[model samples]
Target: MSKSRIFLFLMLCFIGGVALRSLVFIGSFYLWFLFGVLTIAVFSFSRNRTALLYAALIAVTIAGALWYGRFVPEHLALERFVGQEAAREGSIVKDPEFKNTTQRLVVSFPEAPSERVLVVARRYPEFGYGDIVRVSGTLEKPEPFDGFNYSAYLAKDSVYFTVSFANVALVKEGSGFARGLFALKRKFEENINAALSSPQSAFANGVLLGDTSGISKELNDAFIATGMSHITALSGYNITVMLIFTHLLLAQLLLPRTVVFWASVGIVAAFVVMTGASPSVVRAALMGLALLLARHLGREGSVLHILVFAACAMIVVNPRILAFDVGFQLSFLAVLGLAYIAPWLEAKLKRIPEAFKLKESFVATVSAQAAVLPLLLYQFHQVSLIAPLTNVLVLPLMPFVMLFGFAVGALGFVSYHAALAVAYPLWLALSYQLGVIHYFSQFSYAQIAF
Candidate 1:
């Protein structure tokens, strides 16, 4: 590896070390710094000592900053109300997410030693983004459940305590960019419903924009049975597929590669933002945009750099995601599979014709599945024995579904009838994909439970 790549590698090591330490304990960040210092000391005799030392020091600083930003708030917040419940007022920091019969919102307290609380509200009477409300509820701290640290999951976003079924009054309505984005997202969901009927509409909402709110339990189970749950869970693969498709189509328009690359980046970023910039979406956007910039600069060898750097950056920004976020884990691993394993498998699939996206889809599916399989088994004990086949059959149709879904929403913004026209083919592809999932799910061995 080049010096830059070496630097990237060691930097990632530091960040990964910090992230792993955070997963197991708190207030041990200095250990990571010491480890980095030791690593640099070991490299002191190398010809590239100075350059590598700077790299190590930079990584140490990032690791320290990320750990501090991640835990200091939680420490202070826990000190404030470690044992008792008290009335507190905070601004609703995030849009209310209504999932599986519960409404979740992050509220930021205004008082000293401010902390963010993940408020689990009653199913009804939804709250909006930026809503300032006085809340009185038992502050329950999150803890690990079933090998997944629910606490770390919330802490990834700087949330320490949770308010359950709290007595919340909307002292003020939400405002600003996030609020508008939330409203727009709700409108898009409404448009999805208007464009397609139930089940299909809900599934499309999930696939195209990561909204599985309206999907029924049975249907969700079917998706998992077919090993297609990644689509519903906002896998970065979905976003990557859309970006590739958009780029491919626009490349034929005779647009300059520069324009096409940046346009694709913009489109991917816009979609990520519209989908609330979930960890997976942001990761995918970063990776996709990095690839675009790579192609633009004629430096394709930097893909590993891009992937590692992106993962480290995300960890620095939110280290909790390193272990706690399943999507984050699967997304990075899947991309790694694509980057390394897929190329090696080309000879194995050389006989399969690459037409109609058959070859590409199969290779990508197998690569990602192989990379993510162990983690899947560890994190979610169930596995779809036929996931490779299911993905091959369904993933190729995703781009069409996504594009048509977007068109339906954009047109629905104007007229329902216009949106309906696009919905015909959109629904057709979605139904076909759903039919594939449904059929595969019928087999007794399609998926196995632990």
Candidate 2:
């Protein structure tokens, strides 16, 4: 109990249990009260005031998380929609996700909305963040599909109901920082489109901004067949690579390492915002920042503590994620694997080729696959057989593609000629990438579906 990590481990177990209990509506005020008393009575026998303080804060957080998940207003439930036809007025609270066939937006009531609803509409007359609108349609709850709990999946984001394409009337446009963030994202996407074409622009957008909606099913399926889809989603691995590239790029500009380090954190923060701030990216960014802080303090041994602390904080912030969000699970496990297992794998593979960092890239792909394979199989039901080969071929070029793509997109804001010039080399890299994916996808052995 004297160990600093003892409290941390206990907190993790407590939070995990509480979040699990929340899923089935198992939490009540009585459970919270009894748990509080038991915790206090146990701590009463100890003299560790610091531990007491930590435990108290943790207890409160778990209590809140339990309450939020299990006890909300009745209107927030899916039962609120008594019939199929209904009309509701709310504001678009999240950025709309535009795909080839549909546009999905999350709308919430203007007056103290306790929950958000997913609005699926046609891919026309687009809506951005923070637009007041009147929606008319039949409300339907997502159903389980292919053994997947689609309802629980949407519940993780507090989305309880969905409305298909209906008449959507805009009441007003958005303002403030949320609006500005989406606006900037739209501009950046336009720039990428201006510089590249079809699958090239699609690949470059995915590399630079995690914009995969533009990618055709053929190209996307190709990446999936090759086990390269993770790169396009901008998962934790991609975010980690982006952060490291930003740090190196800043350092090369003659900035002090400390300044460059913090700036990189800021840049990653901005990137997360631009990419819709999924739990995986946010978790990776926070953990990366925590490590940066530990290094800045000149004590690397504290990294483990910082990692645990950051995970706990994120879990407490969104307790539902612990149980429902696959992104959170994959993100944390991926980093955990890299931190604890990649070194051993890297050493074992050192006898392998180092050309274009092929050995390291292959090992990284293997280590991450080892860590997340079980979850991926359960969730996605497909495993890529050619993942190692494809990773070795493509990973070494990732940093460069992302850098040049960002440059070309940014330069478009200032100079079109410069953007076009940069696009040529960017095009070459993307063409090679597209070629590799297309070639691998043709092999029936590339992936196995369960």
Candidate 3:
């Protein structure tokens, strides 16, 4: 096999090993033993090239299993502290997520810096990222409820403990690059709010910065029913659009391709940081970066290869994410659909009007929704029957919505009046999107439940 083929095979084997562990528990000793056996088999088969390749691939697979096995113990380490009421000092690692009257904070203690605890507190006592807080509450592991593996979901982030209605006190205000980034993010959010009204401003923030904290439950439910919630949560689709927009806009300035690529990468990196670099965004960014690298190198990189490389790179860092993070799963599947299914769909979708890129958007929406259908049903217990229609209506406007929203938010920092001028187009875009969501969501058959 060619070098690229060999590399792809090994990567796939490694991912299989990691997924195998996720589905079936294999002890460390067994994994290590398998690794040793594979090593011996490789040596024994050294005289036979084919046998050696097979042995090597098996070894790589075992390595993946071992990689995943290493983290299993750390996942269980926090269980000991469950059921105890304790006050622990920790820094808020992520921006607090506010929903209605409650704010959820992911705090990491110095004692166990790698592990995190989700603290649920009142929305009034706002805590920013990196704030050192003392939390007092009964520590509990998240239970799998409503057919959701909530524990596994949290486990993907090393968040193994939960503290409900916690007595949280800020011991010290945060300071550092992360804190500064968050402060900037908060300022942007304030600017957005000042420029636009509730729900619309909230939607703007969601698309522009992946800040869904301001989105209302009713609007949120509408998005969910319409299968448009991914717009609010940054995903591969948004990143792809942003990257393309950046490249084209920068290209118009007559910059060299190298300069444009690097500048786009920098902007995306900044966007990722501003969005707190959640795993899903990071995954999407990695893939986007990979594509940029391929284009820069003048190589026609395979999309499947790029996708696999990005995923394996992430799984190597945090194996649990492969199985536990729903966002990662959705992002991967969506892109996988774009890479493989979308082209087939495009060919079959001939005769769909190409005006306004409707044909392109329709193919993408159908492919992605189809790819993620099984996972959605398994995870959420419902399917958006109107997903393709709603996505087709909204996807085309997303780039404009994001651009205008971002422009208004950034302009708000300089002048409220200046921001309002930009906000008009953004308002119109959001109104249309919200209208589509509301109009489609009202249908009884918009979504179907098991």
Using TM-score, give the best candidate's number: 3
In terms of lDDT, model 1 sits at 0.74
lDDT of 2 by residue, 232-291 (tens): 765565555455545655766898878887788777776667555645567767765765
> Which 10-residue span in candidate 2 carries the lowest summed lDDT?
69-78
Report the poorest 10 consecutive residues by lDDT, candidate 1. 68-77
Best by lDDT: 3
TM-score of 3: 0.90
The total of clashing pairs for model 1 equals: 0
TM-score, model 1 to reference? 0.86
Ordering by lDDT: 3, 1, 2
Query: Candidate 2, which segments miss by more than 4 Å at Cα?
Result: 1-3, 22-25, 33-78, 248-256, 273-283, 345-370
All candidates in order of TM-score, best leading: 3, 1, 2
Distance from true location, Cα of 381 in model 1, Å: 1.7
> What residue pairs are clashing in model 2?
none
Please give, for residues 386-437, the per-residue lDDT of candidate 1 as tens digits: 8878877887677677767877876777899999999999988888988898
Question: How far out, in Å, is residue 411 in model 1?
Answer: 2.5
Clash number by candidate, in order: 0, 0, 0
The reply for model 3, stretches above 4 Å from the true place, is 74-78, 248-256, 341-374
